[model samples]
Target: MNITKLIMVLICSAVLAGCASSNSGAVYKRGEARQVQTVKMGTVESVRTVKLEGTKSPVGTVGGAAVGGIAGSTIGGGRGSAIATVIGAIVGGIAGSAVEEGVTRSDGLEITIKLDSGGMIAVVQEADVQFKPGDRVRLLESGGTTRVTL
Candidate 1:
């Protein structure tokens, strides 16, 4: 191949490799913001049922893959390439959706705490609290609530 063609291939490979490693150090900050309070009064009036919403179905992945495959095939030459593209898309879509489903799930607690001021607040608590519907608890300001062990 000519030097120009070889240089183009090398540049493309470098760009793609860089793109692949760009998100290696990306991290997500989890947990809620902390709050400090001098005095707070609350009584667990009643534990309410908090139905956690199920994750969204991974329909987007399948849809995206199918769309991508069709777009990809258009770049190659001829009818055979178009057919290959559609098949590739169908396979990609199923694989992508499966991966998406594996990653999305429920993560926290849904609890309703009633304060002494006759005010009520609903929040997600830690899983280790072992709180159930009808459990009494005390709301703490440091992003946590203590189950009133009675």
Candidate 2:
């Protein structure tokens, strides 16, 4: 591929990577700051490794399609090139979505915690921290979001 197309692919990959947002328990969104959170004490009942799915965004699909179309246009002359471009774009779009998802997928943890209030709940977050059974943790809940932290 030409330098321009290569640059475009690199940019698309960068954008897809940037689209991945943190789901770690230690990370908080700007809106979550200064807001009151209901703190609950709990003990970890179990910890399991999990896979976090990646994002499917138009940026990947469109970027791939554009690159594919350009690459395909260099095929046979006239109508044949047009058809190739269309086919290439469709195939590239599907491949791009899959690539985006795979690239953004991350490891996460499913933590089952037993609250001090006699309730059992399981929380999943990015596995940036380790947890084990019987470990004391805090469950911070606000705006329907709950995070397990030590």
Taking every candidate in turn, the Cα RMSD to the unseen true structure, in Å, is: 10.6, 1.1
Candidate 1 lDDT over residue span 112-150, tens digit each: 667677888766532334556555555444334332322
Cα lDDT of model 1 overall?
Answer: 0.47
> Residue 150 of model 1: what lDDT?
21
Name the 10 consecutive residues with the lowest summed lDDT in model 1.
20-29
- Model 1, residue pairs in steric clash: none
Best by TM-score: 2
**lDDT (0 to 1) per candidate:** 0.47, 0.90
Every model's TM-score: 0.40, 0.95
Q: Write the per-residue lDDT of candidate 2 for residues 13-86, one digit (tens) a residue.
A: 88888888889998999988999999999999999999999888897788788878877877898999999999
